[model samples]
Target: MSSAAPVPGRFTFVLHSHLPWLAHHGRWPVGEEWLYQSWAASYLPVAEVLRTLAAEGRTDLLSLGITPVLAAQLDDPHCLSGMHHWLGNWQLRADEAAASGNVALGRHEHRLAAHALADFEQRWRHGGSPVWRELIDGGAIELLGGPLAHPFQPLLDPRLREYQLREGLADAQHRWGHTPAGIWAPECGFTPGMETGYAAAGVTHFMVDGPALRGDTTLGRPVWDSDVVAFGRDLHVSYRVWSPKSGYPGQGAYRDFHHYDHATGLKPSRVTGKNVAGPDKAPYDPELAAAAVRRDVADFVATVRQRLIDEHDRTGRPALVVAAFDTELFGHWWHEGPQWLEQVLRELPKAGITVGTLEGARADGYVGEPVELADSSWGSGKDWRVWAGDQVQDLVTLNAEVVQLALDTLDKLPRGGERDRAADQLLREAVLTVSSDWAFMVSKDSAAGYARDRAHQHAHAVREIAAALGTGSVAKARELAAGWCLADGLFPALDARRLRRCRDEHTSTVPTGHTSAVPS
Candidate 1:
């Protein structure tokens, strides 16, 4: 469209933003603090960046995946109040740090805290749904949604998978008055027949890791006659910005995410050098960090331009490159990441490179011919081993049992009356139990114990409520369900009754082909 022949056809930046249910859960070790930290450090600042761009009339190319569970938390009244209070506490902490002689760090945090507080009080007082809705409606960000609870869908029961996917889409519609045609499939995970389910739910496009296509990830291609396109992440580009061992974040000039000032609960040092002890680290100079952002931003932009040019020449057409990453990586993990994003977005267009949303690419007729995709995920080996391997076998079994019990309990419920709160609560706990986070945490040993306990607690809730019902004590079951709902309440949109059992399976909209897999 730009008449520049070698300009990369399109680049879509997909950011998946999610957190396990943590609102009414504990505070310190693995609970509300996790939520609040990401909120203050990531979501608020990221949203502010996007909103500013939107106000300046730049509305294209950014795709954000806010999982339904995450959406539930953002919209919940409890989380809104908690986030407000948390911001106030953040400012107070910064003030205390300032008085305690960490003046530079104190002033820096105090500014961030004050800005976050003002932003929250003025714009976010109602709830985050409205903020996200504005972005979606304004076309500043393309909204990518997923299952109600973000189940590792490939391993989930097919019927519940459909139920979760459909309900998840419906939840988006309920919030913003429009159903998203594109979804960020949880974990970028795919099982062969699952595309039919996506088509059935009206999803027109989704993402997967690059290796899912045997590393030929230059374009969005249809999977086996289904018009729904599957876009693969260009890991060469994504990992250049964020990989475990090395990336822009690990650069010496950036803020050190691990170094904490225990006295003030603040990070006060830059990444002085690789693996250097926290105490030996030098003070964080904002000027140095700012310079790193500029250098990284320029380097990343050049990387994209060259990547697109290479594909354009090889394929004789404008190529599409999707660089996907977690939304938390921006302001939370990388500190200057959001600033880097802002700069890259602003600079790409000026560089004569085409940048637009995945849908924009489709509308521009940029989709290539269909390709056969193997079962894959964005994990270590581009396989499902992370969620269903020896390391997490116990979690795998726990998830299967919880899901089966939930389906059985919901099926046995009497149909068509007032809402069945007990059965609804049972389903909520079951889905939460199967969140891919637990298995991932266990696999990575990030917080295995806490992940196991959370999964088991929710699974136990499902069993207790189901047992009470089976014992012919409806009153007792209701009481038990009410108690669980008090803590596990997030998706008010879920109905156990919506669980779909396949009716003959074949669909004209979705053409079923065959299954494929790669070894761990």
Candidate 2:
């Protein structure tokens, strides 16, 4: 007699790792610190865990969303030099802490700093691309590409939107010698007709929040008539471990993120309690944190298994459950997060839940019928309000003006003047101005000033450069573009002439269904 097929179903973790173009910008309390901290505490440890799993012959483990902007910084010479210097400073700070008689924190920090320094020298000396290339080439992780600078697409000029998505994938191809089929869609932000752009760029699948699908995220659904799939994140499975109210990271036994040792620049306290002050929290103990990791790992595994089993039972078909999170959460916000992740990935497989990438899930026949996706994001209320709301309406207008200015200037360049340095840099500045990070900051009220200032600064650069090009002084235009390029030069692959061709082609190609606006 034939046996019934097992139905526990598929599971995968999607980590969207991104930061603004912070290199050569501010350093101390804001910019470079953010980069180095996430590098040391998050990227390094997470990469280590994935590599370890790969060594055991595991493949298609998770989908990793490394935005083009972040990849540029990780591969930039200036940022790598700064990262090295920062690691050296970390060691010296640890020595100072030890000299000041904080032996426990001092010793712990010293080891961490030393290990990070060695890791950077040995693996990251060439930059993060090679590290990612290893995983991608080995089939250990699926790469999810995004727009040139993680732009919030809903409010962007259609011409600029197509250019950004095309160039972003080109950026990935230049780095890894292949194009990605899926994207994270910068904060999971989307609206109707964006699917036409996705199809134009050859994107096959992308992510959205569960609420975007009205909470029916058990499978991937096509948007309208477009074949490009929209994968809804399983928020119940994800938020159970990182929600606003309660999560594993909030346990009193885990290391506290908010509290830090002012001297050594390291966190040395446990959460202690939900309402406890940072200064009053207990000293962090590895044993206790380890215990919490174990418990949380078990709890999370149970959650994934139960979610998969329940969905399968209801549908009589295996479902795909993707738990997505910010990559910075591991080792950066939650110190033991990487360890917990390693455990989750390892345990899920043993629990009869197949751990695989989204591509893998789809290949294994985990897909559903098509549906018209609503305008939504993974932000507050699964809507475009976070990137287009009244609070960020100023940024919305600014992005519109900058994108239009960029396209008009690039479009009007004297026939064959497309490859001009001024034109290339104008596109660069304009792309940076549209970065989704700005609206995200304003919406969340976190570093709103910095975000606004960055957006305006880039927009101003675009305006000034466009004005210079209009002056008939090609020399002065080149000078201005070069100056800005020195500070904000990313996307080394940006070709004004090539983009012009694509822009011209894409303009006529945009379907009538391709209208982009905020949905009320």
Candidate 3:
């Protein structure tokens, strides 16, 4: 008999889909433009691929985490308008390019751009309609929820954390007709007390990075103090697809993200030479890229198949490999990402890998011994330096001060008419203060200045409320609350009573030892 090991019982793909709320707000390098681009390049296209697979009767399993912020934009009337206009603009641009170029170049550009626009509108634009519902109904996609604004939970005030979680769940229910069973945890930023919040919110599972499991790479399992389960992304298998240095997207044959032409502001070429100048780009051929995609898919599937066999041989249990990545990396960052994804899903099952969603693995009886998760985030270096780095020191300090101010103000307020309003306002300001955007922007160095400004803006609101409470300036407090409400639009269901309850509950249950907020 051949000595080949049995195939893995399951595999999971978790795609975390998020973009900041950017309808009428910031644009260009940092705001709504980011939203539209991701919609065009990633969200719309990814959804189409899943839908196509389902149409073909291939329900290859996947879990998708669409942040509440993105959901809000998706269902918002204003954003719908903006996105439609943006698509029309893209079509116009393609038309202009086709008219101006040599026949061969022009025709190719026109066909590709028109195909993209048509596909986006046909699949994703219907409101509360069937795009997401089709996937959910079909068993192809498991929806994962996250906080309203994607806050870093470990650093948030206890009360505000509950508000963020509860409101996020509620919003998901409002949009999708069901509560999300799992959350993406807004950057995979998990801390010890977060399980309590997840438990309170009725979330049964969440995604955490593999390093959080110490060296044990497992799939869906439980964590300390939480009846809720945690699924760790299997980095060994995932890194092969998109590691920092050697991901499939970085291959010389793929489309280059960094070398787009500034004048046309469009990517016109394949990644020719690593050292080639930006403007001196070569042409992109979908046929050539398709060949590369097939090779990468074969390599990736082989890696997963081998890793599962190796783990089973060593552990005497059916092994699981959970591959997680940012949803945007698919189409926005890598032009052929959607194509690769479709091919990989179609190919893997034939290789004897049972594709599974996180929930599917759990349902099949994968469970872990309870363990305390170290503070962690899946960022550069897989540590807290991104959130607490020197670049964002001032914003971090401001966040801490604002959180304290909001908490102290809530503590001082009596339970009743005016005091209730004041507490709610403080809670809103506090939740906005803890948004992960500021720290993320600073860490990426993409828009550090804008992030700093936003943090200070929210902090100023918190301070204004604190000052009003201290001086007993009731009228001023109400006015500031009204003004701040416009900018801090998250957590619409925030309740001050919940904040008070969490504080009272936690006061008597403090851990014996304290760990640094920054995970080692």
lDDT of each: 0.84, 0.86, 0.76
Q: Which parts of model 1 are misplaced by more than 4 Å?
A: 1-8, 500-520
lDDT of 3 by residue, 44-113 (tens): 7788899889888876469999888787777766667777788777766666656666344446656766
Instruction: Name the candidate that leads on lDDT.
Output: 2
TM-score of each: 0.95, 0.95, 0.89
lDDT digits (tens) for residues 307-414 of candidate 1: 888888999988888899999999999999889988888888877777788888778887888987767898877788788778988987888777777776666666
Q: Could you tell me which 10 consecutive residues in candidate 2 have the lowest summed lDDT? A: 508-517
Q: What's the lDDT for candidate 2? A: 0.86
Each prediction's RMSD to truth: 3.2, 3.0, 3.6
* Residue 157's lDDT in candidate 1: 78
Model 1 error, position 153 (Å) = 0.7
Better lDDT candidate (2, 3): 2
Clash pairs (backbone) in predicted model 3: none
What overall lDDT, based on C-alpha atoms, would model 3 receive against the true structure? 0.76
* Pairs clashing within candidate 2: none
Q: What does the lDDT read for residue 394 in candidate 1? A: 92
Clashing pairs in 1: none
